[model samples]
Target chain A: MVSTQARNALAALAATAGMAAFVAGCGTTSDGSDSASSGSGGCKAVSIAYLGAKTGDSANLGLNMVGGVKVAIDDYNKAHPDCKVTEKDFDSQGDPEKATPLATQIINDSSIVGVVGPGFSGESDATGKAFSEAGLVTISASATNPALTTNGWKTFHRVLGNDDTQAPADAKYITDTLKAKKVFVVDDASDYGKGLATGVKKSLGSLVGGTDEIQQKQTDFGPTVTKIKASGADTVFYGGYYAEAGLIAKQLRAAGYKGYFVSGDGSLDPGFVKAAGSTGAEDARLSCPCGPASADFTTKYKADNNGKEPGTYSAEAYDAAKVLLDGIAAGKTTRPDELAFVNSYDQPGLTKQIKFTPTGEVTDAVVYAYTVKDGKIGDATVIK
Target chain B: MQFFFDHFFELTITGLALGSIYALVALGYTMVYGVLQLINFAHSEVFMYGTFAVIWVFTAFGAGGHTSTGGIIGLLIVSVFAAMLVSGGIALLIERVAYRPLLKRNSPKLVALISAIGASFALSETMGLRDRITGFVGLDKPLADYVNGARDNSSLPVEITPKAVFKIGDYSVTTIDLLVIITALVMMVFLDRFVRRSRAGRGMRAVAQNPEAAALMGVNAVRVRQITFLLGGMMAGVAATLYMIRIGTTRFDAGFILGVKAFTAAVMGGIGNLRGALLGGLVLGVAENWGSAIIGTQWKDVVAFILLVVILLFRPTGLLGESLGRARA
Candidate 1:
């Protein structure tokens, strides 16, 4: 065994070494981020970047998206071994505070020809301006806010439907189809949620009886539900993810608001059913881009994913990666520069023949609506 | 006004529940700080480890995914016990490995602080690095099938997917929320009593106040410090299990931001005081929820940090003073 004196000396050395390492760590002033935004390679392979919450609250969805992209890249790499597609991943964690800097970092990367996502609408909104100005193409799978379409980001593309298509579809079904006049609209109050809610409310102007704006991550929806119940609203449309939406639906049903409950694509998940439970969420109608468990993609997705549950945007993520590869194929970029190469990405792909207008929205798109029946999402119905 | 009241009740309950989790974590921070007077910056990693520990044990014992009332009591006992042991061991190791040498050399507070921060970073990085290995080993479980069942019966309404709702007049409480809140409160009360009434607790307070005096009084200050670390570790483990039940899953790096929130709660509650940590956690949780209600969800973290700054600027002593029974630890 080592003597006490030797142990003491080793401890002193470790303490000194740790202090030195910390001092080096705090020396981040030298712009010493190890995630070198720009690699030295000048296009041996096409680089597509993804910026989203790979490691935060929305990490679950982020992981699914990354998986879809990785799958796409694997497929693409196999198809054309010569035209290899490389990918760079960054985790903004759904925070706009980090999104701006991440955008700059991604933009600085000389190899990245296009971007698959910035995930949440807030992060997209924050990064869109800079990305557009820098002439980078960004396609989002999950971001459904209407604001993103009109934000004047020419380089942006959405693989799936946006709130513009989704909100009105929801309003039409809930108000006109479901034959409900008295309605309460609740938003998660994020850019996506509030925007979607606003879109639905605008469409259902006379039909919407009342509205409530609840912030995302608020665990209890009792007050919002109570207000809806008191308003005599026969239906409620929540514009948020499953976390808050599940709890809200549970409380509304439990509080005896037996009316219809519907939410935008954000609330599309088995987690909602699990969290809200069966009784409260029995008749709940959840609107999403018709892809979760539908026969079209779910059959293949389930097989490929090893029976893993398809999250809300997994299909869209798959489509986003496909579009990026398509863009690379369309250009036939043996060694084309990123800035020049990505500009020509406004073309057709396997998913939906993606072509972005000056505003960066797909020229033509449709929204899919699904109802949460017994906690499992039913076959999605497309609204053309 | 009706809307205000309608929103108030739910927001308050949510805040209290979320805050309790924060409080559990904050207790660890305060306890560690009390003995060492050096921030246990890595306490969040301990919380994260505890979360994984619960997940690991549940998966191993074949009792994974959504704790039922029947299985919950047993799961809680095992998970809590396992987490406490793991966290306690981790905390002691961290102290012995990272902090003990600095104390022996009488290193500058700045040096110790830097070392603590490094240790925190190291732990966080290690947790994230574990993901790479775990992914390779293919531990990815299809949670939907086991957790959510099937979707075939479109017309038939199965019990709400997680059909365990506890109704209290207007409130529709779930078993998950109820357990989270009760466990947090019970833990806090127990810790308060132990620190206030027990001989060991008194010894801890003495050590916190003046290590030299406690040493002179034959307190075995080193052992006391280790015990406090153990307590902090145990508390972190409990907090992690509660957190997972709320969020439904645990990731490798889940504890970093949570640890920050817990630390903020501890500081908000007044760093050395146990009750302050408790109150601070509740306040932060409520404030974040209410802030989300008023502002937007995007600004939730912003609001939380702003509240911390305002609290620090206005009343550094927090909601409670800087002590459990006596003054500043």
Candidate 2:
């Protein structure tokens, strides 16, 4: 009835409206993914990256750390709509081979401003060079190798105590308080294991004069136990993760060495108890850069997890995310220049007040020792 | 002399018992390699998956939790059979999805190797990814609960208490250790009989000797290959059941390193030899334990590799030497 031009114009308008409606429907999600930032002036979406072991042997640890970061992001977004941050996570899998590629990917991404981790110290080294080259500000919740901060990687930071501090403290404890002389040492041959063992050996050497080295993943300690007995060593220091440690402890007791057994944080897991059983596990001392079981964090974490156990490193992960968010708010802009807001992280974190030296290592961190009693880690001694 | 007298039998017995388990897992690798010269890198994962299957089925059917000796034995039998079936099916699927397409395309042998590695990665990640996704949906806890409930119900009468010990004269052995050893020996006997007596096993060996010749003789090489995978996987499933009984809990990546070691055992015994697998596994286990005993436990894995290299260097055909097929270049 009307002119063709008028009809065509109406149709065009209706089609435009339909497309708009479809886009609006697709973009709006009930999930927190679509929530707007709550800042006074809604900031552009900020992309934060988290890197850790996700798929390989250490995937469990990696998954837990990332889980904590996600919780922090969700909580932060809910609290501050203006702090609109989109989180991206990549798994390094505690493998140097994987870490190099993953770090390159994270560095190449222009949207990443701050990073939560590459969980292990060994992995941190693998990716630290790439990150530093890009001027990216990174904080690790668990990387403890002292050598990580040595190569002058300006952007690297860790919230946990370095092996340098922890190992010496551990050696001192075994030799002085425990008065355990003639110690035999074992390491996983990993950066963490070797470094900590070296540190312990240096201190123990000062007291007991020398030490012995063991290979990683060994199930039988009979030869070592024999040697320990021969050397009159009353203490065995193990610098490895839980798997081999548990096996070694079982064999050591079985061999009747009648010596004290000591190890680092890697041996602190409940699985150690399960593997070694009760008698062998008891009286075994373990050292960890202590983080008190956070009642508040645990309560919230349990609630989120429906009362199941949270992963070991989740608290550190949450704290890492919090530090990054603080950095983001201080930066005043969400653009991906990593150093733009580095100064904003000057504030204290949940576990400790983080202050990075020229090389990004924490200047003040503490380690503590615990004795295994009744299939759990317990004790109240801080090693200085 | 006193110390040697006290611990000699204990160490040797312990070594032999542990060696039995290595033998059980090694048979899977040897059988498949005998037929297909392919490593079946996913074999360990098949073992791991079998364990989860046992856990899942035993739990799902309400066989888990505290049980008497008879109840425990019942659960063990059912679990072993369930694991065998599931693992066999998974092996078939892996071949169908990853290997068959490559074979049909006439891809290079290297491609098959890469595909096997990829398949291993894919299977491991699948479980891990499922866990992550479930966590996001708040379903992880509930799932864990379901699995835990089953585990609790299917528990054996030899209770897992810290103080639990089994007395044998002056020496004491843990219930866990005793169970692991007994189960491993039984599996070895079953596998030995199955390979020597079964009609399907002969078909497998014929295909292994010469696939083209077997095909010409109307032996359906494809069917033989499938059966080999099934048998190999069934062996792995049994091994997994033994492993779970010893290890207590399972993880997605649990088989990664252990699988590599088992494969190394296969190679150590001479790739295509069945009896060689058993011998090689026991030797490797004893060697590993002794290496750790001599040099500290930390060196155990490295020692295993060293032993492999040394054996390959001197006796290129392996300790048991080659029995069938061409020696590896």
Candidate 3:
């Protein structure tokens, strides 16, 4: 019995060793094959990728941008059938950790010549360096954190103006227009929200009454709302996406706060109005670098997307895609050639005359203040 | 100090309402741990599905913000029952599929725990991918529409509006707050009575003490465990509806943090003690609010966990220091 047991143990050990070796071998072989397959220079049908959340709390924003990019791709493909351009979508689910792996995958796939988005500020911050080192050209349509541009990523660009531009515009609207003396600043503690809140705080100065932080996906805002009530602030500036912004606005109103509710581009979606309810979102103001898409673009978007009106950043996404398609049309097909083309890119597109600075900042980006009136986001008026 | 005094009544009222939710969810964790000595990590998913059930029922009836007071009451009852049935069903399914197999094989405690975690993830991701799953099955459009979408924060149209019911000092109490608190108290009283006096409750205690010994007493351990899960899940379902009424929104992962807090409450109250769960939850809720009022809102969770650690250091078995098997009603 003892001898048989010893023989079985030896067999088990050998089997375990063999399995571990097999798994390790598989990993190395896959990596070698992946590298071997890429880096071929030939006339291949190049594609641009849309990297953002297509399903989640922020799905509306990402899906809308994808819609806009698809329009640009359709127009480009229709114009140039031989030099065919296609779009591949990568869903990050609005998570930064997910974006990192997807970014690495995008970098490995050499067929993807350029990218239209990583849509959110958090995802952009997470994947910026990987794309930069890989020399992959990425033009973000929505990410507005000013710190993103400061990362010194040569391949990164954005069509929207940064928070530094829009925060002051929001502060001016709150202080000069509404003339609110005491303002309470709140953020969801996300990278995007905190940066914008800090910018608003700097612009507001002494008018800022206090600052508070909340987590994303927080449903109850009673304690924060009560604190806001006690602070006796006449204006409440929230720096977060539409999900929490709507709840905060609704709860603040319920807690008897009747003041100007102001936020940045993150709160510029129609879902914000739906979340806040018509009564809660009455007279709420949102400042964004992206103005309303022109009537023609809106019509085209509606036609393409089954009559679903485009939400935040759809126009800018179209413009970003146009920048790449224009470059490809002008004989810039390779990654290096596309990067150089976008670096010195200048053209009139849907949103505005698109031009990138050396640091990838839009040359003439403008901020617009939008008001919620009668349960609808009103027409955008230039903040200045 | 001034902030504390001025908002004392309002803070207390809010704390009580929030505490009631924690208490309902805590009962589930405590009871499950009592019978199986396993923390049902997937209890949060049970609560989450309860929330969806509430939404589905309301939507099916075409209820909206404009529903009348009587209509709201009727809808609330229907939705609460629907939530309870759905959550209880899901809880039984989880036990049969995730835990029973491990228990039958006499697996190590650590393996059962890992299984619980896996089950938790599976349920949450399934809900998150509801749309894709429905689309793949080629369900009819209207049915698919109901099952799909809303992976993010979805708010139910306000069926019950908060109207001032009465005033306490300078603070006004709303009808919704009163309703939630009263409903929670009623459920707690009924559960307490049922556990102390019922025959099945005695079977649960016997099994919790020793499954083999309980088998010798002719008590069906398997049936007793299922009943315990059903009871816990029903309480969680009630809590889910109250949470929706109070917060007015639900998300796929909404139950995660709340579940952690509820489990912490159960541990604080002495895991497996029913009455202790209620006391622990109320204390946690009030303490967190008052702490936030004193310090800052951002430090509320920090203060709660700190209090727990300090309490554990003193009384490791928790405040009441008695499991369900040994405790009186």
Q: Identify the leading candidate in terms of DockQ.
A: 3
* Model 2: chain B TM-score relative to the native chain B: 0.84
- Compare candidates 1 and 3 on TM-score and give the better one: 3
Model 3 sits at a Cα RMSD from the real structure of 9.1
Worst 10 residues of 3 chain B by lDDT: B144-153
lDDT, model 3, position A259: 86
**Candidate 1 — what's its lDDT?**
0.69
**What DockQ class does candidate 1 belong to?**
incorrect
**Which structure is stronger by DockQ: 2 or 3?**
3
lDDT of 2 by residue, A99-148 (tens): 56667766766657788887776667777888888888888887776668
Assign candidate 3 its CAPRI class.
acceptable
DockQ of each: 0.09, 0.18, 0.41
Between the candidate structures 1 and 3, which one is better when assessed by DockQ?
3
The estimated TM-scores of all candidates read 0.65, 0.67, 0.85
Off by over 4 Å in 2: A1-143, A147-160, A176-182, A206-234, A250-261, A269-284, A294-364, A372-374, A378-380, B1-11, B36-39, B54-74, B95-118, B132-186, B205-223, B294-329
Best by lDDT: 3
lDDT of 1 at B87: 80
Native contact fraction of candidate 2?
Answer: 0.15
In model 3, state the lDDT of residue A195: 78
lDDT of 3 at A301: 88
